[model samples]
Target chain A: MGRIKLMGLAVSIGKVTERYPFAPVEVPDDYRGKPVIDPGICTGCGACASACPPQAIQVKEEGEFRVVHLFLGRCIFCGRCQDVCPEGAIRLTTEFELATPNHDDLHQFVRLRMVRCVRCGRPFDTYRHLVRSLREVPFIEGERLLLCPECRAKAPLDWLEGGGDGNEG
Target chain B: MGRSTLEGRFRVIDVSPDEVAEVVRELFEDGCYYATGMGVDERPLNGRFAVYHAINCPKRGVYVILRLTAPENRPSVPSITPVLRGAEWAEREAHDMVGVTFENHPNLERLILPEDWPDGVYPLRKDFPYNRKMAGTEGTAGVRGERHDEATMSVPLGPYHPLLHEPEYFELYVREDRIVGADYRGFHVHRGMEKLAESRMTLNQIPFLAERICGICGCTHSAAYCQAVEEAAGVEVPERALYIRSLMLEVERIHSHLLWFGVACHLLGFDSGFMHFWRAREYVMDIAELITGNRKTYGINLVGGVRRDLSGEKIQKTLKLLELAEGESREVIDNVVGMKELIARMEGVGVLRRKDAREIGVVGPVARASGIDTDVRRDHPYAAYGDLDFKVPVYRGCDVLSRFLVRVDETFESFSLVRQILENLPDGEIINEEYSLPYMEFGLGSTEAPRGEDVHMVLTGGENQVYRWHPRAPTYNNLPAVPLMLEGEDVADAPIIIASIDPCFSCTDHVSIVDAGSGRVLWRGPLLEGVERLRR
Candidate 1:
C-alpha cells in the first residue's frame, strides 16, 4: 500500500530534478558566487585584503608597484571583501563555475602605482590609496598627508619643535 | 545536584587536578551529561595551563564547567573518563593538541596529530607557530593498539570505507559474526583552526573560520563564535539581528534534516526515498541561497549583526518554499515510516538505553532517541530562540528508528519556527554600531546544531585577536556513544548504527584506535596519506 502511494507521489511530483548544462536553472537574487571587483573604483586601500579571512586577497609590493591580488582558488566567497570595501569596489556575482584549465586564470591581479613618502622618499602605499586617504581624513592635508605612516609619526615630533606651523591639523 | 549560580554561560567550579574526577563523578550521579573538555595554554597570562571540563546539567538548568590548572612545565591532570565516559575523546584530544597529559587515561596516545609528529611540541601552546609545517614520512611507527587474543579477530572498518563519506579509522574486534569491541581513530581535517584563530586572524575574521568547521552545521559554529565574542565584550545584538539569526538557524536545520534523512535512506538501501528526500531538500537549498546568498556556509553571521537583511518579498518566497519542502518531506517520511523492511532493520537494531545514553553523554537526536531529554535551544537559549515557540521532540525507543523519527519531527518543527521568525521579523538596525570587544575576558556560547549542542569558548586578547578559541562540535560528545552502541550488534548493522548518530566525522575528525593486546598498527586512514602528500 505504501509502495503504491509512493509511486503515485513520485508520478505527481514528476521531473522536479534540474537538468543543468542543457537547461539553465534560475539562481535567486541574493545568490553569492564568484567575487567581482570593480577595478575602476578600487583605490587599492587594502581594506578588503586585510578583511579577507582566508587571506585570498592580498597587497604585495613588487619593486616599484603594489599589486592587489585575489586568488579565486582559495576564495570561499564569504563576501567579507564586499562588506569591508569602503569604496564599494567588490561584489559577488551569480557566476560560481570558476574552474579553469590554467592556474593563472584563477588569479585576479591589479597593479597600482606606488606612492613615495614625503620625508623618507621611500615607496609605501598605492598612489590611489594615499589620494583617497588624503581626501577622506579631515586631519590629513597638504604635502604632509602624502607622507607614510612612519614619516607621519616623526612629523608630529618635528611639529612640536616647529611650534605646529606647517603640519598642524 | 550541587547548586551554583550562573556566571555568564556556565557555573564554573575551580577544582584541583585530583578533585576533577570526584566532582565530575558527583555531577554524573546527579544526572548531568558530560558535554566536552578543552585545554588552554595560559602560560603567557598565568604561567600555568588550564583544562576545562564542561557539564550539561540541563535538569537543573545550569552548565557546570570544571576548571583545573597545571604548572606550565609539568602540565598534567587526572582523566575524567573513569567517572564520565564522554570525556574520553575530548581528554585525548586535549592531550594531543595542548600536551596536558591526562594521568590515568588508558589510551593517551596521539589522537589528532600524525604518528611521526615530534614530541613535546603541542600545537595549541602559545609558543607554537600557527603556520609551522612539520615533515613526516608515510606510515611511520606509531602507537600500535592493544593486542587481541586468539578468540577475537580485529577487523578494520575505515580510514577509507564506502560506508563513511569522510576519512575515519575504526578497528572492530569481532568473534565470527557478532561484534565485541570497537576503537576509533579520526581527525583527518583538523586544519589547526584554533592556532590560526589565535595567531593569524582578527576577531572579525574568525567567524568565517568557524563557519568552515563543518560543511553541514557551519552556521551553528559561526553563530556560536559570534555570540561568544558578543558575550565576552558585552555587545547587545540588535533585535532585528537576533531574529535574522534565528530565522537562518531554522532554515539551516530544515536543510540539514532533509540531507540527513536522505543519507539515512541511502544507508537503508532505499534509494528512491533518498532521491525524493534530496529532491525535497533542494527547495531548502534554494531558500538558503535566496536569504544568505549561499547554499551552504551562509556567511551572514558576524560578531555584532548579520551581513544581510531579509526583505518582504524574500520572506514570502521563503514561506512558499517552506510549504513545498514541508509537503514533500511529509510524503517521503510517511512512505519511509510505513515501509516494513526498513523499519524491521532499524527498530531495536542499535539500542542505546537511557542509562547508557546518559553515561556516554550523547546529545541531539541520539540522546533524544533515548529517554534523556535535552536540547540546548530550550535549556540554554541563544540568539532569538528564546522568544520563538517550538517543540523539541524526544523518543523513548532508544533505537535507530527513534533517532530517525526525532529528526523527522524536528523538520516540521523547524519549518514552523522559520515561519514564526519571518512573520514576526523585527524592524531596526541589523548591526550594533556601539559594540566594542574588550581585552582579557572569557565567554561561552552554545547553539543547538542539527546534531546537538555546539559550544565555543573564547578568551579575548590584545591587538584585536583572540587569545584562545575552542570550538566543540556536537559530534565530539556523540561519537563516544558509537562503540557502546556497536557492542553486541551484528557486523552488518555497524554502518547503520554508526550513521544513526548522524556522525559528522569532518566536524569531529580526530581519532586513533586501540587493539585488545600487545598494541600494533592495525590500520592507518586516508588522513595520513593526505597529510603526507600535502607536506611533500
Candidate 2:
C-alpha cells in the first residue's frame, strides 16, 4: 500500500521517464502527433468533419465518396478524425514536425489520386504540383482558375481566365 | 596537408584525421566559424560513414569530410569533443543515432533520447526499427543519471513546461543565479524518420518524411531530399521543377524567419511584436495555400520534379501575397527593432564571439551574424540557387541580437528570392520521366534547412529496399552547441540564449531525471561495466 501510494505520487509529480526522443515520449498514448492518411485505404469519407475542432477538414464529393481536406494550422491535432474514422483509414503517428509559412501546406492530407485533365482524355496531372497550379482560383465562386483538363485543351471557357494553363494565349 | 580557409582560398587536402585535426586547429587559430555538421554513408562495397565538420572563414568557406567506419559489429569512434568544444553535442548525437561512441567523450549521455529507454538501441541506428513497434523492446536512450546538476538543483526547461515554445530539454548546471553548464537533451521527437526513409520508404515517401523533420524548414528538407536522390540517380529535375523547388524553399524561409521573429518577440515579452510577426506570417501561409493545394506539406516536391506548377493567375496571387506579407513583415520588424527592451535584452546576451562561433562549427543565421560569410546556396549551388545572386548578410556582433538581425535580413532575402524564382520560372516540364521510382542507386541529398543544412544520404539496395541510409538534420548537429553556448552564462538569459541556437526542440526536455523508480536498465542510463561479463 505504501509503494502504491508512492508510485501514485511519482506519477502525479512527473518523476518517471521513458525512452523519450528515442521513441515513446512522455506523451499520452492518444496524443495525435500528426495526421497520416493512407491514400490507398482512405475512401475519401467526410467522417472527420465534426471531429476537427479547427475545421481543417475539406471534403469534396467527386462521384461516390466525399474527399476530405485537412489544414494543419486549423487542426487542433485532436486526431478526432482518426478516432472517428469508420474505415480505420486514418492513423495519427507521433510526427509533429510540421512547420511552414504557407497555409496550404499545413492542409495537406495523406491521399493518392489518379491524375486526369479536366478538359481532355489524357492523364496530365500525374503529379499533384500540376493540380496545385490549377487550385489557385478554385472552381468555386466561378473563379477563373484553369483546372487540369480544361487548361490543356486550349479552351478559354473551359478554364478559369488566369490559372496556370495552356489557354493563356 | 590541407589548406585552411582563414588563409583566403579554397584548399582541398588529402589527409587522415590526425592531419585533418592539425589543419582544423590551424584554421581554428585563425578564427573561422564552423559552418555545419554533415554525415554521409557508403555501403554495399564497404559500410563507412563520412562525417564533415565544416567552418566558414571570413571570406572563404572551410569544408572537410572525414570518412569513418562504424562496422555493424562495433560502431564506435574516438571522441573529438575534447578537441572541438562545438562538437560536444553533435558527437554525442552521432553516437546516439548512428551508434558511433566517441572514445573519452567527457559526458556521453544520450543527448536526444529520454532517460527511460532500453539499452543497445540507437534510434538513428541504420539497423534500428523505423515504424515497427516491437512490443517490449528497448531503446538506446537508457540514460541512468539526470540532465540536471546536483549542486544547482537542475530545472528541466521543457518537454512542454511552457517557458519555451519548442520541445527541447536543457540540463542547467547552475551555481546560484549563474549557469555553470547547460547540457542539451534532444531528439525526443525522433520519428525514426531517416531509418523509415532508408528502409521502408520509397524515394517518393521522402518528401513526406522530410516535411516531418522540422516544421520550420519543411520545404528545405523535402527539396534537399529531392535534390540528393536526384543527384544519386543522375536524374535531372525539370527546369520548372527546379523553379518550384526554389519557390517553396524561399516561401519556407520567409515563414520560418518570421516565426522566429515572433518567438523572439514573445521571449522578450513584447506581445505586440509577437502578434504582428505572426500576423505577417499568416499572409505568407495564405500565399503557400494559394500555390499548394494544402498548406504546409505542399506535396509539391516529388522525386524528379515538383508536383505543383504556378500559372499566371496563381503567380498574380503570389505577387499579392508576397506584397502583403513582405510589407507586413517589414512593418513588424520595424516595430521589433524599435522596441527598447527587446533590443537591450538581445544585444549582448548569448554572445558567441566571432572567434568562438568559428570554432564551434555552427550554421545558418547564427554563423552569418557572427561575420561568417557562408551560405550553402552560395557555396554549393543546388537547384535554382545557382542562378540567383543575393548578398549573404554578415554582422560582426556574435550575440543574440546579431542572429536576430541576420534572420530579419534573411527574411528580405527570402522575399527577393521568391520574387526572382516566380518571375523567372523557366518554360519547361516541372517533372521529368527519369523520376520513375528510384530502385537501385546511391544518392546523397543536402539542402539548407531553416535551422541549417539538412543532408540525407541514401544507398539503393536489393528488392527496392535500402541497403543503407543516413540522414543528418540541422538540429541533430546544432543541439551540441547549445550546452557550450550556455556554459558561463546567467540563468536569466536562458530563453533568448536558447532561441539563438534556434533548436526545433520539439523532441527534447531541458530537465532529465532518472526514474530510480522504473528499474528498466536504459542503455544510456547506466553504463554498468560488463554486466554481461558478470552474467557469464
- Best candidate, TM-score: 1
Residues A39-149, candidate 2, lDDT per residue (tens digit)? 666655456764443366877644322356776776645455775676677777656668867766676654445445445544433233334444543454223222344
Model 2 C-alpha RMSD to native: 16.0
TM of each candidate vs. truth: 0.91, 0.65
The runs of at least 3 residues in candidate 2 whose Cα sits more than 4 Å from the true structure, single-residue gaps closed, are A1-169, B1-64, B70-76, B113-116, B121-153, B161-165, B435-442, B462-465, B487-490, B507-536
**Model 1, B349-410: lDDT tens per residue?**
78888888888888899999997779988888777877889998999999999999999999
List-wise, what DockQ does each model earn?
A: 0.71, 0.02
Task: Give the DockQ of candidate 1.
Answer: 0.71
lDDT of 2 by residue, B1-536 (tens): 11111121123343455555566566667765444443434434467554545444533433343444555566556666676666666676666566666777788877655555556665655555576564444444445324343445454565432333345556566667677766555556555555655666554555655655555566676776666566656676666777778888888888878877777766676654555666678778767767774446555676677765688988997898899898877766775676676788988777776666656666777777777776777765667787886777888887889889888888898899999988888887777644343454545566666677665555556453455555566655456566666777787777778777666654222112211112121111121222121111
